[model samples]
Target: MGETFTGASDPKTARIMAFGDLFKAASHRMLGFAGLAIALGGLGGLIVMLNAKPEERLLPDPDLTPGAVVDVSLEEMCEPGYAARVRSVDSSERKQAFRMYGLSNVDRRDYELDHLIPLSLGGSNDIKNIWPESRITKPWNAEVKDTLEDVLHREVCAGRERLGNAQWAIRTHWIQAYRMYVGSEPERFVAHSRPGF
Candidate 1:
């Protein structure tokens, strides 16, 4: 259930090859009904893609993680070390997050189990608020999002932005939020956490 003889590298490629194999096997068994099997093979490709739900494309997969937030007031959220005090994602929850994203046999470092709304903005650590953010996904990876989180937290803490609005913006379409709030130059914000924790 891995790579085929043709050496289809990625999982998607491997699955497509597997579909071809299935079509061939069916053709062998059904004799004259090879065309029908080929048709089904095409359909199977769509099914494989549907099964492979990505954690995010441009925005988040709203179905899997729409973001959840705990009841923390402005003062608490703005307080120093607030995110650190509230931040907690145990191993079991992390594993559950992986399963939710249809990921298995993956290196944890390859993905960041990201909080869609982010703890800094009073986002909940509930499983519903989390998703496996691909570290490899360009221009919108976890690190990129972290910048937005930091920016939003600052805005919220400074009374420049509403907590709910900030949360909603990030939760719904962080890419847009990045533009709306963090501005075009997000690289400057990277690796710079708001001190204390």
Candidate 2:
């Protein structure tokens, strides 16, 4: 992971470049990456990064998106409207995310710049905590994840679930986490899809 790349001389881009953008912006910039250790995402009963294709990868690389968060009391995190009050991801950051995923020309409707761990769970708006979750993909798209997020938020606020576990679920395998917490059809959805379950 010590091996790194440099990116657009712009100070901001330097901080935002990711694997796809590194390749897509080859003519213009690069960025450094560390913590190559990956968290698992599953498909078809096996853990892999978005079907295991690097260029086609859909989920955030744990090395790039480790789900940043800030320390907050459960009460603070669980307050109604808390996520809305704290949520903030600018347009430029959204562009950065699409570029980071090598999605320069994709239809905006096809994706949502999303938080890995939701703001409701104390997730930060840091570039490192966000990714372009698909709006089109089925069985494991952003909408489905939203259901899981709401469930987790309720669980955490209810004192029935630990905040850390909710955070961990988003980072590791949400599909699996969904089974345990969301009480949905396991067969209809699953993917360690960036630690779903």
Candidate 3:
């Protein structure tokens, strides 16, 4: 029965045999791919083992600490439309404007603080960081201007972190002022109303 079709197989039998061969070839290719994947994985593991330090390998990058405050500068705070206001402006205003209208420190400075990141945004209240500018200019200040960018670009930079302590302090003072003047709900206190670059 097997010898009967040895010389010339039927078309149906030939087709079936061809399909079986193709199936075997496909299975071999799949197994080859899996083996290659495993080999590459092992090689990668070996490479990592050879070069990686024990502390550096399993642990996250030590330099990459979380919640680190991004550094900003006062000169970087000033944009074309933005200007620093006198830090004293908040305390010096006439009673009519501050007491009656309930003006923000930035507003009292004519939106100068808005041209810079408000103390509310973790910015400082020093003269370098604070500026008195018009309300139209407030929209242009960068909320988080990078001093590093200026330095990297080799621009003439000034007063790095000079205002940080003052800024932080003034921000606290501003929060207190808001609570005193605006009766809390201090989120309504608008310091960053202007555009910053």
Candidate 4:
């Protein structure tokens, strides 16, 4: 006999009606709309903020080649003697001069100037010796750290030698060496040692 049609349809019939498919489509559309709305809101906010302020022209980027050192005289400009004198001022004077003038935290609170080579390593306290870094970062020690890591990499099947090659280009070409005057500690920004001065 045929199944009775007393409006007691099988529960499976409800799924077969494809209501789940319709719900999924609606949900996907709603999610897309939500994402678009959020992106538009962020873009609009950025535009408004930018428009509210007058645009200040930025100075041209300085030549960062090592030879550009001609612009700054090492001896006449950044002597440790001058830095020590600057550090001797009264507390209020420092706050007014350094903080008020936006030269905040531009002094070495720890660590002496590291000659790229220690005087023990034939590194003088000359401008080349001076790269302000944390006391923890001994100049030669930084090189040693890299050497040890390289050794580890060699032991580990010379994993990604190209990464090592690319590292030197970025370090020498992109990085700017700063005069090691009594400036702020070198900020190890991300994977780079950039002087915040």
Candidate 5:
């Protein structure tokens, strides 16, 4: 015979060709999936960076008084009537806060005399607990801080978080705490209850 011709010539050759095609298809699919994963990961990182709030680097007044014994517990602050009383902001105190932060020339509407550690988390009314947080700031404004305050208070009241730790977290690095709770920097300051409130 001159030459015998079969589609695959032999069973072994046919099997090898089939496996090669299958391997090529599988590798192509895997490469596509890997590219997609890499693109998605980069996008996620970009979104996080865009939404991340910048740290304010604010420090509470060192000479000011700290939380006193009478106002030391979250339980005491969480009481409806007590919370209301502590939340009160007299005009003089607000002005004093502005002065404390050297913000006398700044517009009052542009900022809030925020408590360094919110009263809802058992922060005292002392000057050390107060600061002038700008509302004009992108993500870490007084309103954003207020949202964190509410969440932390709820956690403390429910025994899911320690009151002392909540206070310390805000005092130490509120922007970081905000990122952890909000999952991104705030784009605007809108007061809405977070999940698990």
Candidate 6:
């Protein structure tokens, strides 16, 4: 027959058994709370990542020359008719700029020889200002940039934004402006035209 023990008969053993049970319960609760904390932390990180603005991704143009100057003045280029005549470069010049940027074989149809600082904002026509902007890859393509150019042109002409500052803003980081105004990067090229050059 198995021995039937009572707390009164073996007080020390009873206390030891009770202590062990209590310890086990505490250990389980601690582990559960720790796991929950880790899970919540992971969820918080994912939420932050989802809510934050996407980083601006762009390919660097290796052919950009430092301190290259544009010969044209803002007043001359900012006029309504000036962009058509002044901003156009010859095919050989375009090809040369493309070659300098290591994009020799790229189809001209797929990219625009974009000015880092647009002519309307007094950006130079020099090779330093030109890069092969991808129509497919860039968040803000040539068409979108045309809109930005017009906006800046209006601001500059109206004396709302300084021409030098506008040029610098486009040259320094055009992507940030694109993100600010456009909200997000387009998944693909959106074809639309604005009135006036």
TM-scores vs. true structure, each candidate: 0.67, 0.65, 0.18, 0.20, 0.59, 0.57
Best by lDDT: 1
lDDT of 5 by residue, 14-50 (tens): 4434543444454444445544654777756444433
lDDT leaderboard ranking: 1, 2, 5, 6, 3, 4
Ten consecutive residues with minimal summed lDDT in candidate 1?
1-10
Residues 110-132, candidate 1: write the lDDT tens digits: 89888988888878888878988
- TM-score, cand. 1: 0.67
Tens digits of per-residue lDDT, candidate 3, 1-197, equal 01011211344234434433444454444445544655777757445443432212211111221111224443444433222332233544343223322234434544323313243223334333333323332212222122211221222123322333323212222222222222333232243322211
Residue-wise C-alpha lDDT for candidate 6, range 75-178, written one tens digit per residue: 77667887666676678878887887556665788887887677676665667677777666544566666666666677668776556555544554455444
lDDT of 2 by residue, 1-197 (tens): 11122234443223233333443343121121111213222232233223433223445656567668876778888888899998899999888878876568769898888898898988889888898888776556778778778877876787765676667655555544555566545333332222332
What ranges in model 3 sit over 4 Å off? 1-111, 137-197
Residue 1 in candidate 6, Cα distance off native in Å: 99
What is residue 152's positional error in candidate 2, in angstroms? 0.6
User: Number of backbone collisions per candidate, in order?
Assistant: 0, 15, 21, 1, 2, 0
Q: State the local distance difference test value for candidate 6.
A: 0.54
Point to the candidate with the largest TM-score.
1
Error of 6 at 179 (Å): 3.6
Stretches of candidate 5 off by over 4 Å are: 1-53, 57-73, 187-197
Error of 6 at 117 (Å): 0.8
CA lDDT, every prediction? Answer: 0.65, 0.62, 0.30, 0.28, 0.56, 0.54
